[model samples]
Target: MAIQTAAKATIYRMVMPDHICPYGLKAVDLLKRNGFEVDDRWLETREETDAFKAKHNIETTPQTFIRGERIGGYDDLRLHLGKRVRDPEATSYRPVVAVFAVAALLALATSWAATGSLLTIAAGEWFIAFSMCTLALLKLQDVESFSTMFLNYDVLARRFVPYSYVYPFGELVAGVLMVAGTFMWLSIPVALFIGSIGAASVFKAVYIDRRELKCACVGGNSNVPLGFVSLTENLMMVGMAVWMLVKPMGVGVGH
Candidate 1:
């Protein structure tokens, strides 16, 4: 069933800065485009809003209220919009892309393990490793983070250690095994399980701990909340593993 979202009067504001101010304008434009009547009163700060906030412990501007219900900040606002509307399609990947992505992940893991510095690994020296992992997973999976997911004994060590020792090495091993499919269908399942662990680790550290931190998962440039995205990604991999088990595609030489 589709979740019901509350009808809301939105307040989009940013602090004094032209660049930031445009975000509010853009939001107003989008909301209006979507058929919601844009009330300038909601956009502008009024004595009533100020008094409402003062009475109810609101200290932030650009705060949204739906018939007197508070709707937090920009991120919350965006999420609400996503729920209410659907957009046009962009690019769609063919199945071949997933195959290529898996092969690339395996190659990266193998190369990094050979002659790569432990610190290089710890510093997450292999950019290809993360790229391959993300691509193979369709930019869907994560290798868990600290303080966020399962917070076990294994997790504590990851926080203080370097990347080389943590993910890349293990990832390299598992990734290679996955591509090889040497152990029949076992390889993919094993890799998926390991990758799921990694995803959980990253997700836990970011969202649960509220750490607006960089994911040293691949290298950098991956800074998303480790929540539903992480879970969904792993679930996809799990589905792949099941497919491999049912239909073990004999390793074919890539042309």
Candidate 2:
């Protein structure tokens, strides 16, 4: 529609000497983007802002008015415009689910190319190893963030601190060695050490202490829940480590 024909919106926001309300700018931009001509009103002082809030019976700045009707603040403006917004605190397993799903497909492809079969012991082995590498990649993206989250529930990380920084590198190294099927001595120890500590920490935090927390399995910023899934990841590492360690003997085993 033409600019003159667009709907009109009036927004009252705070733009004081030392502080500007970010949501006010967002509300104005949102209105303009959605075929509305915005009248951006600024309260330049604390007294003016407080008076506006008191008069309108609202608690926040960036209060929007559409056709003389109150439309609330930024988040409320989005809802008014029918925009889909995510709930930041809602639990989600999306990250781990995507990583594991892609890892499974990669393992199947690798197995088909190597042995002309998808359902094989090597495929299963590759799946676990690929998952480790994929999960490690997420952590490696932001080591500081990953370490901060790791310290929340990790036994060694909480005490040693530096261990949190070392954990992702350890996982990556072990994963690469497992894939190559070489350097078993190095890979086995790294996996077992980290895995045992992780499993114990998770069990203590969730099962014993009954604390509800987010899992750092995928990454530091992930919303994946800390419970069975996290425990399973650590257990998988331990299982892979033990199996690879014993495969050399006549009993026959593999990652």
Candidate 3:
């Protein structure tokens, strides 16, 4: 897309019915800050989103077609700023990073809630870990289904071996171990591992699915864009994981 040299630029945003106004608001804010007039009425409807998709051979929300050229999503918007717009910020990550840090903190707090019952916690652990791993594997096909299934089992069964268990009980133990381990000397490695898992999951979802899907990673409340949003989430997870593996803190330590 050609750079907008005039004092103002015209951009249209399509908001999903349930969508909050992040992309739309951010675009308007940035453009106005950089000397552009954003017409609030220019916001598009679902029909407009679909129509533009057909018209310009594109598909997605917050789609920026600057000067009749499709600039794609938020990432593309950043790219436009970097390549064309003057005084581009070195990088736009404050919002992304802040959101991620908050999520990681939340995850750490909830990890222990599962321990209310061995059976109950075990089930929850299996559900979340396998769910995340499967989604990642499905999106990326990182591992064959057979292997992925086995790994998922390994995650919950091996580390936490229950006496009357199915699959590798050790894995279930490890989940708790790693969560605890974050506070121990091994915190860094554990954090990296956990972060890697999250990163891979998010990467597949973003790069492959194109961030079209609302993330259920933490939950619907935290649903956000792909790319930087996902990356920040993983990074935050990695930070918490490292803290766990290194210091091995338990519940109630301001985790």
Candidate 4:
């Protein structure tokens, strides 16, 4: 099939001190990829950029114009090109999936280094512990954002706002304890309690209420959907708590 070329597009972007606009480059690239010849215009100074924005009555930079018709910024250009443009608040699973994948890799590597094999029970435990820690860390980065999103679906958080803040810290502590294989007496209860509450909240929100919302599992800024990923995280915690409680001591220790 002959690749169809789009109409020529013009872009104006800023290149100032510590303020190189990334979307401008993206806009140029997208135009070229779609076979549109781009007239790349540079605003050399901050004053020029601001003046351009004022004249155009636009708020942001990297503005695009096609055949003398204003096409807005990078996102607008993308829409004009018929591409999937993700909303800032849209829900997705990429963040949680990425964290879990990385955790699994790290667990496998650790197990291989210690036991000279990848397939081991210790690896599974390590994977869950690492996943929990990573997820908690993301939430901790922006606790207020996480808490706000969490309150939307978390039953306990809805009742008590303080619990939303506490949840991340508790998750982090439980993950650390699990990884160290020490303080089972404390970690077990913490994991079980949080896990049970999380599972119930997710079930009620997604299944019973049928509400679609973003998950705070990866973080408040993330777009991870509130459903299977959330349920899996809670289930992992529950399983890890049970395993820690019943497993033979020192079985996976010192590795």
Winner on lDDT between 1 and 4 is 4
Q: 14 in model 3: Cα distance from truth in Å?
A: 2.1
lDDT of each: 0.46, 0.88, 0.46, 0.91
lDDT of 1 by residue, 129-228 (tens): 3333444342224434322222332253455544323444444454445444455355465556656665666566655765544333322223433344
- Alpha-carbon lDDT of model 3: 0.46
Clashing pairs in 4: 92-223
Top model number, TM-score: 4
- What is candidate 2's TM-score against the reference? 0.68
Error of 4 at 136 (Å): 0.7
TM-scores, all models, native as reference: 0.32, 0.68, 0.33, 0.84
Residue 168, model 1: lDDT of 41
Residue range 1-255, candidate 2, lDDT tens digits:
645688899999999889998888888888999989888889999999889989999999899999999999899999999997679988988888898899899989988887788887777778889999999999999998899888889988999999999998999999888888778899999999999999999999999999998988888988999999899899999999988866645331132
Model 4 scores a TM of 0.84
Better of 2 and 4 by TM-score: 4
Q: Whole-model lDDT, candidate 4?
A: 0.91
Model 4 sits at a Cα RMSD from the real structure of 3.3
Tens digit of per-residue lDDT, candidate 4, span 1-255 = 997766788999987777789999899999999888889999989889889989999999899999999999989989998998988877678888899999999999989998999989999999999999999999999999999999999999999999999999999999998888888889889999999999999999999999999899988888788998899999999999998878886676334
TM-score for candidate 1, residues paired by index: 0.32
Any residue pairs clashing in model 2, and if so which?
A: none
Flag the better candidate by TM-score, 1 or 4. Answer: 4
